[model samples]
Target: ENKPITLLELPTSIASNTILTLLKLITYNVIFAK
Candidate 1:
């Protein structure tokens, strides 16, 4: 029942969040790097 929806939505949201986090880290590094 709920399994199908979890399978479809979980990975995508997780991936997007991960990508957003990485982008933030990269941007922070670039701004603060000496």
Candidate 2:
């Protein structure tokens, strides 16, 4: 049967890359702002 959990499973790679990019951006912003 189709379920909501299936939706969460579909984007693992994309989510990780997006999260990593966001983290890097935040870190760089903090460093430059200092």
Candidate 3:
């Protein structure tokens, strides 16, 4: 039997936002390191 997928099974928008924030932080660190 096939089951339906649910939103809870996937990463939400907040998770993506957090990832973007982390990337930005890393980019800033790299720029400042130079």
With a 3 Å backbone cut-off (N, CA, C), the pairs that clash in candidate 1 are none
Question: Per-candidate RMSD vs. true structure?
Answer: 4.0, 5.4, 5.0
Question: Which of 1 and 3 is ahead in lDDT?
Answer: 1
Q: State the lDDT of candidate 2 residue by residue for 1-34, as single tens digits.
A: 7566566676996798899999999999999998
lDDT of 1: 0.89
Residue 15 Cα positional deviation in candidate 3, in Å, after optimal superposition:
0.3
Per-prediction TM-score to the true structure, in the order listed: 0.77, 0.69, 0.64
Output the number of the lDDT-best candidate. 1
How many angstroms is residue 4 displaced in model 3 relative to the true structure, after the best TM-score fit? 20
Give one digit per residue, the lDDT tens place, for model 3 in 1-34.
7566468745675688899999999999999999
- Report the lDDT tens digits of candidate 1 across residue range 1-34: 4555577798998999999999999999999996
- The segments of candidate 1 whose C-alpha lies over 4 angstroms from its true place after superposition are 1-5
lDDT of 1 at 34: 61
Per-candidate total of colliding backbone pairs: 0, 0, 0
* TM value for model 1: 0.77
Model 3 residue 29 CA deviation (Å) reads 0.2
CA shift at 20, candidate 1, in angstroms? 0.0
Q: For candidate 2, what is the TM-score?
A: 0.69
